[model samples]
Target chain A: MRNLHTDEIIKNIKEMCIEANYKLASDVEERVRGAYDQEATALGKQILGQLAENLDIASEDSIPICQDTGMAIIFIKLGQDVHIEGMDLEDAVNEGIRQGYEEGYLRKSVVGDPLIRINTKDNTPGIIHYEIVAGDRVEITVAPKGFGSENMSRVYMLKPSDGVEGVKRAVLETVKLAGPNACPPIVVGVGIGGSFEKCAVLSKKALTRSMDTSSPIEHIRELEDELLLEINQLGIGPGGFGGKVTALGVNIETYPTHIAGLPVAINICCHVNRHVSRVL
Target chain B: MDQYINTPLTMDKVKGLQAGDYVYITGTIYTARDAAHQRMYQAMEEGKEIPFDLKDSILYYLGPTPAREGQVIGSAGPTTSSRMDKYTPLLLDNGLKGMIGKGKRSKEVVESMVKNKAVYFAAVGGAGALLSKKIKASKVIAYDDLGTEAIRELYVEDFPVIVVIDSKGNNLYEIVLQSS
Candidate 1:
């Protein structure tokens, strides 16, 4: 068994948080450039161009790409064979989050109460989601979820008979309702099957995939292409300006559903697309 | 393609703007979001004076991250305008002339812009770091207790934005969605 020191994990987590917020991943940058080329409308092309510029400026300056900087959302895939040596695993993750937000100068947007809000000085106690898997190495992913697109996310419990068309309709309706509010030329992450909460997880997880990769399921792949075409047709251009491209891409993930219901969820992500991962 | 030159922009300057124009704003602006606006408007509701003069002034809907060493401001960019839509008309009625933020605004606010000769601008939502370069200095003027949501006096130079809603009640969001 490989023993990982708690201090080491905490240190790595802090660095990962700072690095992810400061820099746009190369894969994300390349995909934005690719979208700029494929964008059919002049306005859409311009919007993507500006996005590319934003990334460049943020990276060079070592600052966050978006003001929201988001809540520090961490997903952990723990290896059963490995042992956490120095500190509680959860404590290590939270310490990393606290240090990152404070050291990186990122905003502390988290509030004490969802109802009667009170500010937490440092963005602490990250919303950590963990999954245990058979392996020797632990994997971690950090996604900074901004409020705009997160506000537009939705989940629907559909009748099993509703089938594929139901899923498409729900996805389209969500985007349409979102309109310019989610930020145009956005990325749409759709999760089909699973329970309500699990479906939401699947939707967010779907967003972590490389933007250039296609869905493994053939039917879902075709659905993604069709939806991408349809979403762009909505004409919500860059920054919600009049343009030809409404969305940059559509990605879908699925799992077996309960025999009684077909569940679907949609997670909308803004252009900042801030997320980073590490293996330990 | 039209321009609104200079800053501390008057109603005359803002009213002249129309949708689809790119604007370079320079000079002084104040920052406020949900909390500060609510508090200020509440003061106004109680017939008390606001912290700053609203007439001919532009308000940026942003809650910037804390600044690092030697930096005037951190990644300072706009937040969603729709979240502040509830309190905006009241501010507009009290001499607010311009707003800078992303996402859609209420029809009532657009009507207020048309009625009061104001303009609405949009700064790129995710381009916080790039936008921070335009801010020369920032000092909290009111509601420091609100943390990031505090009201601030900011000096900006050539701050890039697009005229999203003009005095004529033209809305770029409506136009864009229609065309799409």
Candidate 2:
């Protein structure tokens, strides 16, 4: 078994956090530019232009793209043949986030307690998800999820008979309800067929997928395209002012579920959809 | 059509604005979000003095990131306005003449704007870095313990916004819906 040092993991996580906040991933940037070119309304075009400029400034100045740098979400794919050394995996990840937010001058948005509501100060205890995979190298992805869109996400457990139409309706409704609040032109991430909680996780995972990538399954890919078209037709547009580019992309992820249920979740992401991955 | 206006908005100035007019505001505005609003509303109920003067003042629903060295402020942008709907009418009654935020305001809040001759403006959401460039200066005016949620007094220069709701209850959101 290949032995991996915890220090390496922590170092990578810290860099990922800082870089993801400072740089809009190239795919996301390209999609936003595409939307800017396609947008019809004057206001929509102006707003999209500003968003592009903001990203450029953030990269040039090493500043955050948005004030809400968001809570750190770490997704880990640990190789089954590798053993972690030097520290506990979760502790290492949180320490990385604490150092990253503090040193990068990113906002520390986490609160220690939900109801009591005290800032965590250093943005610790990153939400971490781990999976053991077949390879010997570890893959880590850091996604800084801002609450504006997170609060707008929805999950529904549909009856077996509701089918694809129900999934479509739920996604459209979530986007409509989000309106301008969640920041259009938004990214729509749809998760289907899992249990309730798993479906929500799947939807979030869908957000990390590249905007240019489509689902490998033919029918699922078609659904994504259809949803993208319908969402834009909502005329929620850029910043919800009114235009033809309400959403830059629609991504859908699915998993098997029990025979009686058709669970679905919609996780909306704002235009500043920030995430980065590293393999070590 | 972009219009330049100064803060401490007057009824005539507000009346001149219609739904969808792009505006650039200069001068002072107060910043408050969920926590600060709750505290301010509670203080108002207790008859305690608020930290800043209220008459003809504009409040921005925002919680900016801490400014780095050599910067007046970090990325500062409007938050979702609906969360502040509960406490907005109270502030409006006390002469808060304008608010800057994003999203649809509550019907009650819109009515309060109409009754009080106030107005609502929306800055572009997710354009914080661009917006921060307009803030000339900022200082925590109250609730420093709340971190980003503290009430701040900001001096802004040509901060861009769109008039979303006017004193007469004309809402830009509704206008967009109808026209589309």
Candidate 3:
């Protein structure tokens, strides 16, 4: 069994939180640049130019990509053969989060209660989703979710008869409703074939996929391409100015669902899709 | 390209501008969002003086990330404008000149824009880090207790923005959405 010390885990999580908030993943950045090249609308193209310039300034200045530094969402893939020493894994993760937000100067957007709306300073008690995997390495991913795009996300439980068409409709509708609000030329991550909550999980998980990669399933790939074209046809271009590039890509991840249900969920992210992963 | 920049936008100047003109903003602007807007407006209803002057001033609907060391502000990008639609007309009536944020405004706000001769500018959303570079200084002016939602006076220079809704009620959102 590989033993991971508490200090190392804390340090790794702390750095990951800060780095994830500050940098735009290269894959996402490259896609935005590609979209800029393909965009036709003069106004839309201008907006893309500004977006590109903004990305440069962000990286050079070492500031966050967006003001909605967002609530901390930590995904942990704990290796079965790994054991944490000196501290509970969750506690270490939370501690790292506390230090990261405080030291890195990222906003603390998490509230103590959904109803009462009391903020938990330091962005503590991150929204952690854990999966135990067969390995000797523990992996952590921090993806901060902004409110505008997050509010536009959706989940649907369709009758199995609806099938692929149903999934396409949900994905397109999400983009349509989101329009400019989700920050156009957005990324669409679709989660299919899971239970309701699991579908939501899969949708977020799908966002972690490499931007240059496509879904392996040919039908799903077709769905992704079709949805991307249909959404751009809506003319919600860069900043909704009107152009050919409304969505950068549509990524779909599917799992086996119950015989009676077809569940679909979409986790939409803006142009500044910032996330990072680290192994400790 | 005619570049007209006003440090502190005056209502008269704002009311005079037409659609499709470029304006680079500078100097002080306030930051506020949903919760802060509600409280400020509620105070206005009670006949209380607002925390800051609304006349001829720009209010950026943003909740910024925390500032790193030696930095005046953090990644400060615009939130969606429609969410604040309900409260905008109230501020317009009180002499607010312009709004700086991204996304579309409500039909009601556009109507108010026409009637009041106001303008809405689109600051690049999700470009907080880059945008913050233009802000030379920042100080919380009101609702300091509100954390990121607090109203702040940010001193900026050549802060880039596009005029989305102009004084004539020529809404870029409507124009683009319908024709495109």
Worst 10 residues of 1 chain B by lDDT: B2-11
Q: Write the per-residue lDDT of candidate 2 for residues A1-280, one digit (tens) a residue.
A: 9999999998999999999988889999999877788989999999999988888877776668888889998899999999899999999999899889988888878888899888888988799999899989999999999888888999999998998898899999999999988988999888998798999999999999998799999999999999999998988888888889999999999999999999999999999888899999
Per-residue lDDT of A22-102 in model 1, one digit per residue for the tens? 786776677676777777766567667877777887778777887888888899999999998987899999899888888
| Weakest 10 consecutive residues of candidate 2 chain B by summed lDDT | B171-180
What stretches of model 2 exceed 4 Å from their correct place? Answer: none
lDDT of 1 at B58: 94
Superposed Cα deviation of residue B55, candidate 1 (Å): 1.1
Give the Cα error of residue A19 in candidate 3, in Å. 1.2
lDDT at A38, model 2: 94
Task: Give lDDT: candidate 2, residue A48.
Answer: 93
True contacts kept of each: 0.83, 0.62, 0.81
Model 3's interface RMSD: 1.3
Residue B153 in model 3: lDDT:
88
The runs of at least 3 residues in candidate 1 whose Cα sits more than 4 Å from the true structure, single-residue gaps closed, are none
lDDT of 2 by residue, B61-170 (tens): 88887788998988887888999999999999999999999888898999999999998999988888889989999999899998889999999999999988889998
Position B33, candidate 2: lDDT: 93
